[model samples]
Target: MSVKTKLRAPSTVLVLLALCLLVSVFAISGGEYQMTPWQVLKVLFGQGEGIENMVIWQWRMPRAVAALLFGAALALSGAVFQSLTRNPLGSPDIIGFSTGAYTGALITLTVLGGGFVATSLGALTGGLLTALLVYLLAWRNGTAGFRLILVGIGISSVLASFNHFLVLRAELDVAMAAAVWGAGTLNGLTWQSVTPVGILVVLVSALLLANSSQLRMLQLGDDLCRALGMRVERTKLLLVVLAVFLVAAVTSLAGPIAFVALVAPQIARRLAGSAGLQLVPTALVGALLLASSDLLAQRLFAPVQLPVGVVTVCFGGLYLIYLLNRRTTKV
Candidate 1:
């Protein structure tokens, strides 16, 4: 059975990877200035000439890479939180991480000016602090899944209201900037923007991989995991920290791009069919979802490019409603 499971998942992952690559190539080849697949290949490998090379290499490729990294990071973070809390609904956006990051970035953009590093640092601080606050508030004799989720929802509402209030109070330019960032655009993503996010995803993904076994143990409940020689509390802390950092980094880079984290893991688990959590597959699925959403954002409306977050939010919200119905029927 284990062997069959192993064989099946690799094949599925391979197929998903193939789809991701194919879709990415199509995404790269698109835009106001279209490039052929071969032109894209040539430009990527530094063998193309003049404008074609410049268009493919300088613009489209970086955006595509950004989508991939952002999607992967969102998916991984969602998967980690889902595993840690044992809740399918667990996600950065739902738990206030996105709101926290948004509030932080908004404060920086409005109060301190649009210094990139300052904004990013502020986002990180906000995300981590919010997560810590949620955890502390949720703590009891045992931190049950329901308690954490309730606390998260409560905190999310407060942070969201605060964020809106701040935006409302800001100057027009600052408020508009904050609103755009909150909408989550990947506009103007150069290679420089892509590189750091790519690196952060890789590093955080490695940490998640290292903690995978412990995460599995965590699903068995704290006392059970303790009996099984797992340091449940420590594992939970590490996973939350890693999850917060992953979401924080991406949110800082791209402004809490909505629904990717919430939707990706659920989709991946459906693909894998049964589930506690599946990391690699979720990440791949996320890359596919975000890349495809970005493609739609660019091409669907044409000249008036909608933010990728808007697209995902619409789709993911519908999907969430469906899940809720299913859960109710099952109950």
Candidate 2:
């Protein structure tokens, strides 16, 4: 990137950050017991009254923070995958990771009948196993994006059927509970619930950011990357693993919240005019999309909040239609 291009990106990031902050404030300030934006800020800084603190710090904050953090995580994963595939539709969820995670959670709930932590672990395990399976299946000579996606689709279809079967066979209470979670809401998130996974996500994100030069280099054709003496396949595999981890972590917390992952990187790349995926800006866009969507989900049907995933799915469907239309026109 040129100096001017680099400068533009940072400015774009700053603006996105500012928008995220504003949206977060708005999100925390809305609800049954609404507060002013100033009050929300005060509560965040630990200077509000009992109710404000309880509402903002205790209830609203975790959900909002989860939206921002998980959204960013999803976007970071998307950036990695899209950069690797050189396709706008290249999202981790396009593979079976999210479905695998959901299947894991379903099994845990139906068999072990475990609580949140157990369920999250189950989801993580399932996601990783699914990734391994897809990688192996796609590795004819070496992994290619189209083959990987195709394998993922098949695996996801099988896993999704298994998930439905599990849910159908389980007790009604257990099935209903699993179904709600599978719908992907930020409704009941608490600090305790979000902390461990949040920390892991931060670490994973740090690793991805640190090794991002390799991701950018991988975009320059395998032969060219090999010419530069990089272990092309190994770097690609490592980055793919890291990207999968980000998705699994997010899925563990919020179920399969879609669209944010598929859309964020493309939006960020356009906004910043980046030649390749720019991680920070993509993350910021994801954060904004999720936070804002969650806020709408909470208020759009006041007193009967919809799962945030529902809003994202609606938006995602529209995005897909637009993408298809664009591709068709070009063809």
Candidate 3:
């Protein structure tokens, strides 16, 4: 890589990181009980007193951090899937993994009466199983990206229906809880809730980054990648598994916040002008998107909060329609 390009990646990442910080501070500053950016910073640094400290540290800070972490995880997961499948549409949300994770959480909440731990396990189980099924069904002579995407879409539709059924069949209170969770809000998130997933995101993201070299090779097509001495199938499988873990981790914590994964990587790629996937930039974009959305969700209605997922769905749904229309026109 040229020195300019090398410098550009870090510089772009720095800009994104700065934006994420700015948005997070903005998010923390706004709410039912608003604070100035200066107050938020003071509270963050242990200088604020009483309610200011409680609001910023105990409540708003954790939620903002969760939003940032979840966004980064989803974005990185999307980038990995897109790279593996070579399809812009190949996201966990589009491919049924998110639906599957939702189903798992529903079962935990409704049937097992489990708490966050149970729900997290269930979500991970559901997402991994769905991915496996999609991969197996898509397998022919080999797994084609288009075929895998189609199979995932089909499975996702079915799982989505099942998820709806689960919600409906659940008892009233349980159903209500599941419905809210399905909508994907970051409300009431404490440090306890954020810690485990935060750790997982950090670890899994590091693994993905370490494998970034091999991942870029796979984007060049299997034959060429294999010619370069990469074990194409093994690498793809590992990457997909890691991607599944990342998606499940976020879904379990945030309840399938949509379209950050689907949109962030594309945004990052466009910003960086990178031919291959830009993982770090994508993660930053994801963080910024989710944190900003959460902030909007909190203050948009002022006392009455909307789910962050609702905002994402609004934007993501339009983007999906546009992508389909563009693809149709091209075809």
Candidate 4:
């Protein structure tokens, strides 16, 4: 990136940060226990009285942090998958990781009745297993991104059907609980819930961002990348593993929060005018998108806060349609 590009990128990031801050303030100040902006600031600074500080630190802070981490994780994973495949539609959900994670979580919730730790473990195992299955099935001596994506979609559909069947066979309350979990929510997020996700996001995101240069190179076809001293297949495998882990982490915690992964990188790419993964910008955009979505979900239907997943799905589905239409015209 040129000096001008570097300057412009930080400028864009500052703008996004400003937006996130504004939404976060709104989210903190406008909920059931409302507070003024001044009160919010005071609480954040640890100079406030009882209620405001408790609300800000204990409640809103965790939820906001969860939104940021989860959103960033999903977006980064999506960007990695898209760049690796050189396909805009490539994402963990598209390639079966999300479904697998969901299925795993469902099994835990249904049969095991374990706590969050157990469910998360199940999600991680499910996501990795699903990706491995897809890779094995898609492999014909070697894996091509195109064939892998096709096989993944087929496997994901099968798993999704199975998930529905499992839910249907369960008791009504259990099915509702499963359905709600699948929809994704930020309600009642605690430090306990955020710890695993936070660690996973930070670690995986750093690895992915550190490898952004290699990812950009990989985008230029496998043979060309190999000629450039890049181990094309091995790098792709690493990316797939990283992507699966990121998806598993967030989906387990947030119930496969939809569309942030699908939407954030596209928005970041347009804003940055970069052909490949704009890692930092994509992450910032993802945070902003999710934070704003959370705020909207809370305030839109007064006293009836929707899950963050619903908002992303509605917004993401429309954005995806637009992407497909645009791609068709370009073709």
Better of 1 and 2 by TM-score: 2
lDDT of 4 by residue, 219-305 (tens): 778789878888877888898888888899987888988888888888998887666668998998999899989999999996898
Give a tens-digit lDDT track for model 2, residues 74-135.
99998988888777777777788888888887888798888888988888888888988998
Q: Where is model 1 poorest over a 10-residue stretch in terms of lDDT?
A: 1-10
Model 1 sits at a Cα RMSD from the real structure of 1.5
Candidate scoring better on lDDT of 1 and 2: 2
TM-score of 3: 0.96
Best by lDDT: 3
lDDT by residue for model 3 over 87-107, one digit each (tens)? 899888988888888888788
What overall lDDT, based on C-alpha atoms, would model 1 receive against the true structure?
0.84
TM-score of each: 0.95, 0.96, 0.96, 0.95
- Residue pairs with clashing backbones, model 1: none
Question: Could you give candidate 1's per-residue lDDT for residues 1-331 as a string of tens digits?
Answer: 5876667667778988998888888888887887788777777677888998778778877888888888988999988877777777888888888788777877887877868878888888889999899999999866677788889989989988988888898999888877887888887888887787678778988988888888877877788888987777777888898888888888887887877888898888878755666888899999999999988998898877888899889888998898899999999
Clashing pairs in 3: none
Steric collisions counted per model: 0, 0, 0, 0
Q: Given candidate 1, what's the lDDT at residue 174?
A: 80
Which of 1 and 4 is ahead in lDDT?
4
